[model samples]
Target: MMISHGFKSSKKDFSFGPWKVTTAKNHIMKSKDIERLTEDLNLRALPEMLFGDNILRIQHNDGFGIEFNAIDALKRINNSDDTLQVACAQQWQESRVVSEHTQEVVRPYDWTFTTDYRGTLIGEEMQMKVTETTERINLEKLRAREQIVFFDEVLLFEDELHDHGVSMISVKIRVMPTSFFTLLRFFLRVDGVLIRINDTRLYHESVPTSLFTDPNEIAQHLAFKLRLCEKLELPEQKQGAVNEDLK
Candidate 1:
């Protein structure tokens, strides 16, 4: 999908299966912020592994980490196009139970989904498609289900401290083919605290009393947890120093 530089000011709400999700404020990451992260974390884009106009990647000292990229439908079939994709390495003591050393840590199984989204038939189909496409890229099958759901775009906010932990927050919008309604999914993860929140709310429709916790609130909580972790900040760079140097 084409990368959109504009920000949507209005808060949005929508549903995916049984869960309701609401859009929080757009988390904007300025070019300076990207530069700071790149310098502080020694990040590099894995262009050969994933394709996108914008990509930021970093790994933690314990081997768990994440990659954020501009969402693209063409790459979604392989589950490589999410705004933020996190991988918890098998060697990480906290993630050892779920890690599959034989397979790439970035695969679908590591993703934590909301109960409503995970239990639905559509959710199952989505997972199957990801697994199948990951194993064998089939453009045809991916496009066939274009009507069901298509990842459109996302905004990301992250805090990664090498020896401490990593916190990632994503606000992603998905399009549903059958209706004009767009689904807003808020995802948050804090490796140090072992906290994972994947909540969905609604948008473009009348607000309903949701039975689940508000996604925005969950995001705030995660942000708070992130703040409690040791901060990782690099000294201010000189005027023209190269920012692309990776350790």
Candidate 2:
């Protein structure tokens, strides 16, 4: 399915974006491996994609991090600013990897709806209501509805393993619109799980870096946004009532 994947601003910030690495040379390495190196170097991997040539990894220390990539200085002189282009490719590739991982993680479950309108007047009218997500996902039901799977609600999810402690599962869900006309009334789960309802305005909101940085945060942010969107997008009657109440 074609999606209007959003890119973090930066024509030059190519290290991470939407394209998946369809094919890569053997020299390519997994992001986790690079992250391991970052830890060994006592670095924190921030979003920045450093190095022009080769794969770029972000690194940092003291609670700060930056991006790093393979350095082939020669590639720089040979009309190949390998550092920049490689960073761009890595950025694009990593985005694809994360996007795919998120998709894989969220594909199995159905987004349960909620009935609670208290979250907001808008939500009361537009969103499905449910209490716990687990209550909503009927695996067998999902399998049966596979024909309309694309229209099924989508969620973005991620998990992280700490050096010491149990692994963490992060997740977020969005209501996907059935068509372009429904874009204003529905939302789609994003890689970050920052659900964007209505392609009009709220979709453009910038969330905290933490949401994109961690899957859990993404999930939490998504839930909060969903609640908020529900409150904001009131039906015609509710909107009129709210206006009358204000007057």
Best by lDDT: 1
Q: What tens-digit string does per-residue lDDT give for candidate 1 at 1-247?
A: 1223455444444544434334334435455654454345333221111112333222223333233343321122223323334444323324222245544333332233212231111221222122222233233433454454434334443333223343333334444432223323334343644655555332222123452278863442232333354778999967875668678
Each model's lDDT comes to 0.34, 0.24
Worst 10 residues of 1 by lDDT: 43-52
Per-candidate TM vs. native?
Answer: 0.24, 0.16
For candidate 2, give the lDDT: 0.24
Top of the candidates by TM-score? 1
